[model samples]
Target: MTLGALMLVEYLRKDMVAHGKIGLTMALYSTWNRGSSYPRDKVIGLLGIIEPRNSFKPEYSWTVEKVYRVAMRAAIAEDGNLNCLGLISEKKQSRNKNLASWVPDFELHSEPFRDYITSLSKVLNKWSIYKAFMIPGGSPDITTDEDDSVLILKGFCLDSVSVVGTQAPGPDFESVGETDPELWRSSTRDALNQWRSLLPPNDIYLTGETQAMAFWRTVLVDLNQGRLASKKGGRPKRLDKSDLQDLLQLETTDGMEGLLSTWESCLRPIYRQLRLIEQFNRRFFRTESGYMGLGPPDIQPGDAICLLLGGSVAYALRKSAHETWTYVGECYVHGIMDGEAAVKAVEDKSDFTEYRLV
Candidate 1:
């Protein structure tokens, strides 16, 4: 194996020995021009060791002992490839018009039918285990009778549970303005005025284009210095430029207001890009046919969505009021009930959710 691959194995082995900690979690990996070289960043991330190699500068090869350290930790009892758990990659070449390849270790298995069945069974058992503990989906009888396992095996039915969630706000078009003359005056006066007010006094002599550049330059400088940003807990934080692009490149709001407001004080720099708005649909909003469009695609009935709530908040603003809505249930289904039908069905019939496949 190449140094990169060896490093990956080392890190994965470490994660295995740690019972699923300290390993790269990426489902897909791409090497330059489809190479065998280890990804430098991934190795560092997995091993917590900085493999100092500059893309612009060549470096020495890794030592055998370094690679062995990873291998050693992964050995369950000194003779195995890994001790606690082994991660396998199941990559395959693809001919689809959209994607060229599929990655993710779980997908790499040859017996796809069996693999998916096993995967689904494990997931159901996991929920069943938790349900036995009186958790949200837990039932009292999941661990009860021998016959319960047989009933649950008939086919899992997901239950529909409604949790209160805050509705996301609509697009802030009044702040940004409309696209057409009938709706918008098409005047640059207000935006220009606001831009002028934010300018440093010395920029007065600058032409409009130059002044705009200067204003953005100042914001960029602040961004570089970590000034025009927000921080939470102990880590450094910055606005996600991708989320902003998705908002601009696509016309619809994807409930990303919290992510958008990090650099809200510096909004003009982002809004000035006409191409971003034009490209939003294609980049941010993907159609059902997989075609790109403007703005974030709306959540439709039967669409699979995850529900994630924030752990804490400092504001009552709708966006900050609760955690982001995770896309959990299948998007094509209208209600959570449809997505969880299998679990509910199993519970209804069996009075239990968890069971060992054995």
Candidate 2:
């Protein structure tokens, strides 16, 4: 069995010992890789392990798409949070076009990297780091149509994408054994330079941090300073003054290329963290209001950055029809991640608009 499978087994064992019943959402996420010859088995096979309180039953006649859709809706309703939405793949990575944009494709294992910083598999653990909806007393307000095809949510649009940069190199580019190490470094440096240029000329973001600081933080999803902030009981914090000084040094140096050549010890950790993010398929984008972010690889120029009621992170959404939106994947917008946008909307008395996701 793979390491992930083993970890899942261990987690289930621990859960049985502590809680006596596995959580429906945690069970689904952990067993996502347990595929079978029949696609329906993906959801049905999980029945033996999950809690008896769950309403899922073997529906052999249902199509694979329907099974996944039902499973996703049930998981969200039971969890009372939008964490399951984080598992939805980017548009290009998804295999089932028929499945609703909000539903996760169980067959496609797009995320291979499981480092502490980027992996979303452990739902409870990652929530501490990506708290986009930090406001207290918030809960998911989810409903579905008669056929359960449309997912209705309540949230406000945060911003619209205006500029999108090139996608960072894939995992192949960073494989030292298969490709030249120098080529990998050179390509990454070039990508970083392009992303840096895409930032607006403004020195400071609305969050009051320097452009350089925000750029670095966003690329690493604000987890670069070390794993302490993301520990079990810890909360994500801003990059300190010392971190800013290192970034400023890189800024003054003759571009990223020059700084890479120097190979300074202080800068190595930051670059290492950045490389971790680049290995994942994602793109850097700036919103119309100048907010910077890193999102799914398929994110586009006009996609909407929205903060769903109970989501722990911001999401990228595409308007597919006059009255509905398509879920583009989760994203990391710099300025409004920690509930700043929600606070402002509340102060302004902005109404929570209904988003119908197809």
Candidate 3:
């Protein structure tokens, strides 16, 4: 076991530097290719990045202990609403066109390393214990024999409720002439309303790209240091951004106006990347009330945004059967998603028992 661990570590060090520090998956791994032996960053990065492929096998050379090592490497990627959860590869491998959602799609390509994700997810599903859940699919529940192998987890999901895609002001706002500011203004307002429809009218919306939160961090990081309050409080003491602050001072209108202003301030950052908008809306967002946040790959009818113990945000999974589930995508749920609701779930003894990834 010790020798195996050493070999795996040495192999991964080369893998880490060779791949520019990008995370590794079991599928991507080849025992024969030990990777570069130099340019070591001494950092394995987050375990979430590696897709646990199955090309590596047990008895021959790979063991369950090796699988645990892979998951341990990913264990560091802990976030409540991680911006990169449920992340899949845009470049699909032509042959790997048929995955039944058994694995968490955290790879850069559709064809996971030899379906290792299936086996890896099973291990993680077991290790997750209380927080285990299946993606929306069919996989018979099976148990891993620890005596035959070591059990470990790569990543887990968080309890979330909704997904909020970008609400970047439309092209009209960008190209609209200043001659009729009201036209541009009205168009922008209409867009804001459409964005609002993605989430609940009454519930709060927690976004992923948070420059606002980062800005507040500068102010309170020193003030509170390690105070849990700073970590748990909601709405960052009245939206500290200067422009939004000034707008609020001028007009304290509630309802849509306040919502619009807040929504507008969030546009530039959320819309920072044109590519991410679709993924966030379709794959990452879900809720019980309807597909709020981002849509099109709309939230399915029975989808529930759940939080796993070590996850960044709530992950949406569809219950295909009484206990069978398949991963939908990452999500940014409002209210309970401010890194507190999941804790409350634990306090309430809401331990999960339905995860069975094949």
Candidate 3 regions exceeding 4 Å error are 1-85, 89-97, 102-192, 197-298
The best candidate by TM-score is 2
RMSD of 1: 20.1
RMSD of each: 20.1, 4.8, 13.6
Give candidate 1's TM-score. 0.20
Q: What is candidate 3's TM-score against the reference?
A: 0.40
lDDT of 3 by residue, 1-358 (tens): 3332343465466556665453333223322122322211111222234543342122323332343333323332321112222332222232123333422223222221211111111121112111222222333223222432221122233433544433323322222222243443465555444443443444332444233332222122111211122232111232335534443222233533543443333234222211111221132233544423332243554565665544434455666654456555544343333445555555677655545422
Per-model TM values vs. the true structure: 0.20, 0.82, 0.40
Per-residue lDDT tens digits of candidate 2, residues 1-358?
A: 6444555566566667766778666676665534477777767777887756544664888888888888888877766777777666434643687889888777664233322123332253324455666446556678888777898988899999999988765434222223344755677677778998998777888688888888877875765333344343334345666656666555664645554443222123223322223225578999988899988888999999998887778888899877999888888888776788888888999999899999
In terms of lDDT, the poorest run of 10 residues in model 3 is 117-126
Tens-place lDDT per residue, model 1, 39-147, is 3322222333322222112122543222222322222122211101112112123211221111112212222111111110011111110111122432122111232
- lDDT (0-100) at residue 180 of candidate 1? 38
